[model samples]
Target: MTITALRTPRRLVRVRKAVTRRFARALTGDAGMSTVEYAVGTIAAAAFGAVLYTVVSGDSIPDALGGIIERALNTRV
Candidate 1:
């Protein structure tokens, strides 16, 4: 085999190994926790938003707000 051909494969193998090591480190490192934390925070925020929406969409709040608006609009200008 020519020197050029043999050197090319070694270069490619080294590059491949570097990429594999980086990928393994990234997966086994603390960076992975950020994704889980973000997911949990997103879920919690969604749940809180749902609760607030339920409260605001309830009958008593709308009726009370409607009464206030109705009174204000009906008042003398």
Candidate 2:
């Protein structure tokens, strides 16, 4: 075999090993969200819930929902 042919397989093997190592590292890495991220997410979710509750608990929403329910109940089957 020629020198180039021998070097070709060795280079391919080295490249394959490097790619495998990188892929394995990427899979097993501790690349998750941190505590600060969790706190921010929690605060954001709470604020959203509060806003949603305030909107739903307003007088107009309840009155509209009650009117809908009354109309539905009064509809003849």
Candidate 3:
């Protein structure tokens, strides 16, 4: 194998070790990280679930929203 190819894996391993150490330290130092992660993940999952529910229900929310906007714009005071 070429020098570049042989050295790539070694370099990647060292970088991975460094990253893992840092992540471990950060997790230990930050007591609220787990809670923050859970909150963010829950919010993301809920958003995804809502979108999936809307799609699976065959509801055209975007179209309905657009129609409402168009109606409001076309209506006179």
Top candidate, metric lDDT: 2
Tens-place lDDT per residue, model 2, 6-61, is 99999999999999999999999988889999999999999999999999999999
Give the lDDT of residue 6 in candidate 3: 96
The residue-by-residue lDDT of candidate 3 on 1-77, one tens digit each, is: 89999999999999999999999998889655587799999999999999899786665877788899999999999
Off by over 4 Å in 3: 30-77
Which runs in model 2 stand beyond 4 Å of their true positions? 1-22
Local distance difference test scores for all models:
0.94, 0.96, 0.90
Query: In angstroms, how far off is 58's CA in candidate 2?
Result: 0.7
Colliding residue pairs in candidate 1: none
Top-TM-score structure, candidate number:
2
RMSD of 1: 9.5
Evaluation by lDDT, superior candidate among 1 and 2: 2
Superior candidate under TM-score, 1 versus 2 = 2
Candidate 3: 10-residue stretch with minimal lDDT = 54-63
Q: Which clashing pairs does model 2 show?
A: none
TM-score of each: 0.49, 0.60, 0.38
Steric clash count of candidate 2: 0
